[model samples]
Target: MAKDFHPPYPWQTGLWQQLRHDRQQLGHALLLYGRAGIGKYAFARYLSQALLCKQPHSGHPCGECASCHWFNEESHPDFRLLSPEQAAESDDESAPSKKTKKKTQISVSQIRDLNEFLSLSSHRNDGARIVLIQPAEALNAASANALLKMLEEPAPDVIFILVANQLQRLLPTIISRCQKVSMPAPSESQALAWLSEQGVQNAQQQLAYASGSPIQVVNEQAQLTTLADIWQQLALGSKLQPHLAASMLIAHSAETGIIALQKWLCDLLTMRLTKQVHYHIGQSGALQGLSDKVNLSQLMQLQKKVDELRKLALHPLNHELQLEALLVEYTRVFVNK
Candidate 1:
């Protein structure tokens, strides 16, 4: 086991116990589905490690044995993890470039490569072999069909754990073959406490921005400062300069900047209709003022445009110019009261 390997979060304790208690009755495949950033992947990894642990205590891996060492070093003969190539390289800042298109799907070749691993017997005496596929929605048509064949005829002593953020994206046949587990999200208090322990500032505001997902709040800390700068420009409303704001908006990536704009527009709309804020709780005053000066019909039309632009954010288009045009329209959405 790795030093980072530990028991599940407080919210996941019951699910952990249920699965551990029924370990013998567990099926060959498990589909762990939930919203993004709720620790589903981490839970799957923990379960995989424990299942292959040579000396597990109370269904937890003892971080000392040879098997545990092998697992920690990512050299366990019986374990295999699958993910999109781009996702695997996401941590490297230089991974994304104009010369190379990012691969988003799990190709059929990846699934075919698993056949050899599935055919091999476990290196340990009767120990289980684990194959973990994270964000299982990444499996496209050909790969999903290839994976479905294996699920249809599962190998003995092999456990397949599929982690998905969007359950509907998976093939229905692939879903039907696995036992589905709905991972739990922490409560407001639980999330706040966890964020506090992790030394996060403004836990309440960040939590709201993350849609109550604590993991996202932590993962997105780096961007929060940039978000704040963007919000300041957006607060100018009708006075905002499109060309200047467009540069700041796409500072990270066009996708990230568009998402920020989308959230701000959503909050502004919500404030206009209900006098309530969703994503930008801290900026409710600004949203309320902007909403008062904005035309409802124009705002709605602009929102639709933004949504369409967001769908095409990954396309190799002139994103800065598109953002600038959107911002120009954004200023026009407001009228003198």
Candidate 2:
């Protein structure tokens, strides 16, 4: 019995049918590539269910079989999933505990674990093994090399599915070994429609901030949305209290504050240079006044600083100090009145 799995909306039903046919012929390795939050993970899960289905149906899982139930319960012996830890501490929290925990990255140790797990015989006495590596590019050099070795001499009856948001970040050897499944971002109209259906009122505005990723439109994180609103307010050159607004924005969504700040500032700087003063304060506004007030050279310099800040945010070291510096720089730019 296959698990009762229904595909997510952004996925193509035709592709699902084609995959079912390919599986019959034993496709050993599949690379599912696409923009993040566009249903790649859901599709990967669907394929896992289909492969483990005890009672298959209509090129999908039957959802009622013993194997399917175990899969849904996440107790399937032959199924493996690998993902990065979501919570990495701020520098303030990290310094005192520095020796206790290492910074998070998919390292060789994890690959070794995978190798050991896959070495054993299947519990179902079937030759199938399903392993998913998400954000596959997270694999550091040694880890990726270890994976390459596995790919070179893949186990009999084993299937590896690599899901990557940024395919270009993956190593060439890794890219060369697997069959690629390219997934495009949904069409603009399609994304907009889905966002509206999800009850996003300012869908177009947020869609612009998302740069076409519909998942951002439906992002449940209030801070991500509020971050956009802050940017909208700033770009509009609003008279609101800067510290109060910034504090509220960061308070609600500390998770993505740096990223949101950097990206929004970049876009604002771009507008300043292009002199396309139409701003999105949850609505587009005339830029005539903002265009005159902001200096093009200052905006260019600020853009470079933001780019450097982005690189700094990637490192786990000095996170608090770095965030503080970022806030200071932003204050200098927007609140130096």
Candidate 3:
């Protein structure tokens, strides 16, 4: 995190205070978790810094301290960040799958490498050292077991803070070794107000489109506009040109386009079976028009195909052609009986 980065969101203030109040009582490892876009990772970072700071004051770290400078520069000798992307590179090896692509799992080799760091004492006298692992779910079966060993025999003066978007995805045994901190998801009003403060117009629309993740709204504003265009193409049903639509979607990513379609079709199915739609509340008219002409059996088959494609989205396939084929099938669902 940069020194100029914004503080935690308003909803996090209370939780921050709680952590401060129980600062001294904190365990060796902390599992901070909540839904995606709730700022759990940021909170973990803030806590890591505060704990490592040589001069903490008034419930926060003093940024002027040498310790703070080292942390901000990401060169603190005692501080380590264990994230999937970082782990893959830190092991002095390229990803076995794809050199450029990020691996989702934290390798066991990375966990074992921590033995050297854990063996050392803090760089500063009596000051805490922190190891922050984000999205703890990235620790697969082997990595989780390796981590479990460390948790069982925790090194003195070293703290492990694990941040996760999905706690259920983590190993239950690993979870039992740490203290769980459930981060709060801000209410819709709070999110919209925050977006408004950030000078984001059409806050409600953006927030809804992001499934209430304010961070995603801020990060993906441009993509949202592209999504709107894609939705318009999707509404064309039988008239939609597969190649053109596929190009636009593949430009973003195969996974992203598949997810967008999944969510849209989910709403379409809801609109078909019942008169209500959960996501894409703003695109009801277009979805309603498509849902009527869609054959239920074929729509179900298309959804299954999309799910399968999503599973293989990372494979080295001709993305544009695959999406075009899916879109060709998509148009068939609207054909007259």
Predicted model with the maximum TM-score = 3
Shift in Å, residue 201, candidate 1: 0.8
Q: 1 or 2, which is superior by lDDT?
A: 1
Please identify which of the two predictions, 1 or 3, would achieve the higher lDDT against the true structure. Answer: 1
Q: Give the distance in Å from residue 74's predicted Cα in candidate 3 to where it truly belongs.
A: 2.3
Candidate 2 — which residues are off by over 4 angstroms?
A: 1-6, 86-104, 224-229, 232-240, 275-283, 286-288, 314-337
Each candidate: how many clashes? 1, 7, 0
CA shift of 36, model 3, Å: 2.0
lDDT of 2 by residue, 1-337 (tens): 1122236454456677677677776567889998786778878888888888878887678889988898999888888887654223333255665533434567676678887777887777874888888779788888899999999998877899999988889998999999998865678788777776666767777776666666755654365456555655555453544565556545643445656666655556555667442224443343344544555565567667657766655445544455555554554454333
TM-score for each model: 0.89, 0.81, 0.92
- Candidate 1 has its poorest 10 consecutive residues by lDDT at 1-10
Name the lDDT of candidate 3. Answer: 0.84
Report lDDT (CA) for all predictions.
0.88, 0.67, 0.84
In angstroms, how far off is 165's CA in candidate 3? 3.0
Highest lDDT against the true fold, candidate? 1
Spell out the clash pairs found in candidate 2: 1-54, 1-55, 2-62, 2-63, 3-63, 4-63, 277-287
- For candidate 2, the per-residue lDDT at 313 reads 51
Ranked candidates, highest TM-score first: 3, 1, 2
Candidate 1 lands at a TM-score of 0.89
